[model samples]
Target chain A: MIEVKDLVRQFKSGDRTIKPVNGVSFELGKGQLASIVGKSGSGKSTLLSLLGALDKPTSGDVVVDGVSLAGLPDGKLTEYRRRDIGFVFQQFNLIPNLSAVDNVMLPMEFADVRKSARAQRAKELLEQVQLDPEKHSRRTNRLSGGEQQRVAIARALANEPKLILADEPTGNLDEQTGEHIIELLSSLSRDHDTTILVVTHDRGLARKADRRFRLHQGQLNEDVTAGR
Target chain B: MSVLARSVGNAFRNKIRTAAVVAVLAVAIGLALSMLVANQAVGAKVQELNASVGTTLTVNPAGGQGFEGGGEPLTAAEAATAAAVPNITSVVGTKALRLRTETTTTDTADAAAGAAQPDAGGPGGQAASVTTSLTAAVDAGTLGNRNNTGSGTGTGTTNGTEPARTFTLPITATGTAAEVDSSGKALDITSGTGLGDYSAASTKALVGTTLAEKNNLKVGSTFTIAGKTYTVAGIFDAGTTFGNNAVYLTLAEAQALAETPGELSSMVVTVNSMENVDSTKTALQAALGASKADVTQGQRNLETAVSSLNSVKGISLVAYIAALATAGLIILLIMVMLVRERRREIGVLKAIGARNRTIGLQFVLEALVLVALGSVVGAAIASFASGGIASALVSSNSSTAAGATGQRGPGGGPGGPFGGATQLLTSVTASASPGVIAAGIAAVFAVAIIGALVPALLTARIRPIEVLRGE
Candidate 1:
């Protein structure tokens, strides 16, 4: 469940004003599998960042799970990111020092979960991502790219967040691995009753979503009937 | 884990750097500890020496010219008045004189040989000559007859009679034997008893252990000095070599033997307490001057020498303080370098949401740990090396002085100025108190903290974003 109203995000690059996400608006209901498809420089990542509360909108409002992002304080925004939304980045930004299980347990630690329960939950999540229980103790650096991305996905789901935001989760993987990751993410959205939004330029991945939206010139347009 | 634990773990990452820093700090701490220990040991020695020697105060005659004519001995009335001053415990009167003696022999051949020598007789060859010398015989009876069988005979007689000799010796008068406990008192007898009644007329004397040993004489043994047969009543051993050369006798006996009755060369007054020594000396000097009494130059010089030594001690204190300040600066420099090298780690900790206080505490903990380690190692090393250092310093100074004066004594031999075993024992066994060790540790801690504070504050003020951007 997420909503955006006239969200605007601007960037300054050496005295030039660039509107990456300007006056953008969108809404997604609970358990919806949605995709924002756009070419390069279409503000897809910026729009996703705003919706995930990772970046503040320059103007207008973004409401996620009934909390207004535009008016939230920096501390409250960090809490929102930690507790409400799960993010899977393109590069799978897992801490290099921690093992796979430890990486998954990081968000729960930051959220002050009961210490005894965090490890168990982290282990269960790793299994959900098709990572072997034996490999849970392996450091993230020792894992393959696809395995790391799987651990990253498990870490995103550490707190069992209501909304899952994937900013090109399969962008750095091979086609077969990307398909498997997309299938896993879609299955998680359905099984966990989570609303999933993936921002990607992969048409094959976009075609699998239940709904699709095109982002162009800092605006989002719903295109339900269009397929790859 | 806590931020401090993490920082400590990170600090060990660069092992070589940490070891180098630790070694440098250890050396600095060791040097400082040695200096502090040496200073305390020297200070204690000075205090002990001062206590043993007591203080000197000289009393001079009119216009501070002291006693003028040789015959102007201090009067008994003037001495009594001086002794009456507050804090004056006891006074001993001393006198000196020059006397002459002759040589004698038992054989006619030896007498003829001595008579044939030139200047053997007085001017114009009237009779045998007499040499002006000083002798302090105990009493009239103490000088036995020269022709007695126990006395050794010379080659000639004095003025056609038996050889008569006059010897110059110092005569001192005191109330009791206890007044001469140290600095030439009655000898301590290993065997036999002390003199019977210091007022006795019989000839008795207390000879030094060294003199007794040289002449193979002990208690009850008779010896002749200046044509007098005096029985050795006791053989005493004084602790110091200088004190071992003296002979002790009662003032009355010495005066009677010297033939200088009711006369004193000097009067030594021991005060009851040191608190009023200055005022007592001043009052006594004024009284003696008013009475036209005389004093010796030795007494005056003793007073100035002690005062000058005390002033030099004050200068040594300043030197110690300057050395301490320099040690502090060295410690500070070491800590500053340590803090600067940990800046990156500090930034990383901050970015991880560590509180500023927590981060600062990590750095401070690291510094405290390092300082503690250095202090312990340094103290141990200093304790082991302090003896050698003290001996080296003292020997160097003594040898330099000896070289300048061109007076090369036995002390200038192979083992350095203080002699081998004696110098080593004195230097190495000098005590270093716990207080000195504590002060050294405290000084090192203060310097390290001051050094760490600057870099720690800068690290605490670092912003996460700027650090992450490598700005």
Candidate 2:
């Protein structure tokens, strides 16, 4: 579950203050597969970052799983991100030097998972994401765009966080791979009872989300629909 | 992965960079280790030498350190006063004299030939034609104490039969046999024997083999000096040219020949221990009253040895410090570059719940790995090279000090300049001891911790949000 009450994030650009996510408010029930769709300047990623506790808001508040992220110290925010939300990036920002299995084990390592348990969980998660066992030892750079994205998803799921915040997870993949990635993300709502929030500019990808929110000029408009 | 394993694994992420940093650090640290080993070795040698030769004091007559500068000779009575000083173990006195020879021959036919050469106060031959010039340092007590034990008699008093004139050599010669013993230092007897128990009235003498050969004299042969006739009791081989032409006799005999009675050339006072040398010398000086004698201890040689060793040690210390500083600076430079390259990874780790301390610790761990590798190599190289470097350094330093002119003889003899302290410094063997190696390892760890902290702290301040957002 997530709640946003007039969430605002501002930045100083050459003496002029600009608001990326200005006074935006929204809420989503538990186990919801959601997408925030916006153009390049629409602040969709900023909103996702706020929800993931990756950035501090200039004003207002973001609440996730009954805990507010308002005015949390940097140390606490880091902790909140670690225990609560998992993040996936558009470029599949897995550590380039690490193997696929190692990339999946990264978050679990930060969470102090035992090495054996982390390995076992990472193997299972990678398999569930459809990555071949043999390919798990391959470095992230050596993997294709589609396989890299799947490894990123496995890493996001390693800690079994209450929420998954994926920022353009399929932005660098082909259309077919993008659709496949979207399906894999959506299936998690039923398969793992996990809430997933994806930020993308593609309307087609947004259409697959169980709940959709569109952003324009730092404003949010939500659409609740039962998607097949 | 464990933090250590992961940090080690991360080191190879930039293979070229890691290898380069490690190579530079290895050389810098190796030099430092060498200096440390050398310093330890020289320091040990100095201490050992000091302990080996216990403290000694050589008390000479006033202004007798140089040649040809005659001053008031120390009196037998003043020597007695010096013996009363506390901690005085043994006080040996010597009196040297250059005497003119008178005709002396056991053979009647040769005696008749020598009678023509004139006796004492006979004629003004200027330098005494046919007169043998003999220099003798008669012991008022013993020659070298090799055969003599403490006499339990009055200080500077002869342990032998009383000489005609009351004089003294500081040595307390109270032994049974009168034949030569292997103990006499400055001179070695080649044949015959040392003096028999002779009195002030006895005419016995000890002659060097060189003088004996020149004069064709043997034990039982007779020689006369300054109108006194003497039989050769022993023949000795003085190793140096200075000692070769000399003879030894009872203090009374030598004093009678030099016509200086109740006098002493010098006195050597032995303290119980080196620690007590200075105090004993000071006490003896006070006992003797002002300016009676020049109380010189083994202090110069000790000081020379210590100063030489310290000079070498100082260089080694400087090198060690320089090496540590350079290594630290190099490590800091490399670590900064490495942290800058890994700023993104730091952000990712933070995003994954790595606390700032955790991230900083990871970088520091990586630095330790590098340091470990470099330190091991450095220590190995230093092990091979430290000893020779230390020996050469100490030898050079001590050799310079020993080469100075006007150095006193072992016992304040105005004998010659370079008499004592020549053998003080032997070749020192310096190596990397276990303690030194351990210190080097500890230093490596300290450098690693400090080197990484600066860059790691700066990296910890990087915001994951800003990094990821910019990307």
Candidate 3:
């Protein structure tokens, strides 16, 4: 579950104020699958970053799972990123040198998981994502886009966080593979009771989510529920 | 991963870069180590030489007015007073007299021929008479006489009518002959005896090897000097020239023979150690200030030469320290470059929730590992190369024109007490002392950490969000 009240995220570019997320506010209940749809430069990624506690809100509050993100120290924020939330980047962001399984196991290492248990858990997560055990051992760069995104999803699941934040997770994949990835993510959310919030430009994918919100000009507005 | 393990992994990732940095540091540290060893070695040698020879100070007569060639001997009272000065050691005084002598044969043929030729009178007659009289006088004293004391022929007559002939030549002698030991004590010889007392017996003497050969004389052989008959008691060796030409006797006998009884030519005072030499000389000079005894030039020259050598050694030490500092600076620069190259990796580690102290520890660990590895290799290389390095330096310093020119004087004297073949080899094989090595390692570690600090602080200040945004 997450909540944001008057969240304002600003950037400075050579003495110009850029309000990427201006006075944005939103809430999502536990086990909710939601989408924030927006066009280019609509502040969708910036809003996600603020909610994920990866960036600070300039003068507003962002509460994730009842912990205030605005006043958290750098060290505690890193801890929040490690244990309370997981991120799936649009580019997959797998360390170039590591194999798919090792990439998935990285967050576990950061979270100080037992070395033996991390390997076993990483194998299970890769299997759940329909990735072959043998292919999981191959370097992430050698994997296809869909396969690499699957490893990223596996990595997000590593610490078993309550919230999964997907920033245009399927943006680089073909339509068929992107549909399959969305189905996988939805199934994973239903099975693990984890909240999934995806920021995307795909209206069809937004239609599949349980609820949707559209980010336009640095603000979020509620959209019709997908099933209704 | 542990900080050390991570650093090692990172180091191996860029093998060529790491090797280059390590090589530069190694060469610098190796040179410093070698120079330090050489400096310590030379210092030890200097100390040993100083201790063995001791400090030498000389005392010459006031105003340099006393002796030009030969003059008043340093008195016994003066020598004793000088021996009492602080750090003054032993003093030995010497007196010399010049004399000439010739060889003789006891054959009757030469004696009869010499006697028959005395009637032929001329300038040669006068010379022949003088020779005969001198020979007779020497024979009376029991000193050996020779037949060919002169380069030219002698006259055959004393007064143009008297038959005069010279049978032998003149030779020199002291009043008595005695055996003296290293401690300056006269050795008593009961049987196969040394020279008897010349004042009482007046019949015995000691002859040097040269004198013995010249006269074909041995122990118990009788000879004459200045109309006194004396028997040879012993044959012995002193040092080189001084020992070869001179004969010795008791002081009393010498005074008696010189016809200056109760007066001495010179009195030699031999002290216990070299530490007493300067004081003894000073005390003796002060005591004999009125007596006007003059110190020798050789003593003064020895002191100046030693002081000059000490000044040279001081300059050498300064040069060694300068070389070490230059090497240290080179090592510091190389380590700084290494730390800068690792900055990105350091940021990544910090972003992964590593503490600032942890990051610092990792960098320090990397530096220590690098330095330790480099030091071992460098020390080995230095030790193996020290001989060539030290010899090259020594030769370069000493083979210059100035050094060559300086070698003409006391530089050719006996090697400084600890400066012979043994000392030179020991210096080349000098070992680093434990304390010096420890301090050197500590210094290297400190410099390396300081070098890494700038990069580490920059890494710690990097924001994760900024870095992840790919800035």
lDDT string for model 1 (B338-424, tens) is 556655544433322345566566666666666777778877877786666555554554444434434344655424322322232
DockQ of each: 0.08, 0.45, 0.14
lDDT score for residue A77 of model 2: 89
Q: Please give each candidate's TM-score.
A: 0.52, 0.70, 0.59
**Model 1: per-residue Cα lDDT over A80-196, one tens digit each:** 767887878777766565689877876776677786899899988998899977889998888988999999899889888888888888999989889989898888878888888
lDDT (CA) per prediction: 0.60, 0.70, 0.59
lDDT of 3 by residue, B1-471 (tens): 334665665455568877876787777666666665656655565565444333433333333321123333334455466566554445432222223232243434344333323222122121111121112122311232232332223334445454354433322334322245222434333224665453343445556666565567667877654345656677655433334344545544444444444333343344344445565555655666744655332233233333433443455456545545554565456545655655544444433334556666666676666677667776776677555665555544443422433433355532433343222323334566656555655655666666556555655665545545542
Error of 2 at B276 (Å): 12
TM-score-better candidate, 1 vs 3: 3
Give candidate 3's error at residue B317 in angstroms: 8.5
Q: Which model, 1 or 2, shows the larger TM-score?
A: 2
Highest TM-score scorer: 2
lDDT, model 2, position B321: 82
**Which is the better candidate, 1 or 3, if ranked by lDDT?**
1
Error of 2 at B413 (Å): 21
Model 2: per-residue lDDT, tens digit, A28-132?
Answer: 777888888888978988888788877888889988778888877888888888888888888777888888998888888888889999999999999999998
Tens-place lDDT per residue, model 2, B143-229, is 423322331111233336742222221211111112322121233567776665523534677876666776778898887764557
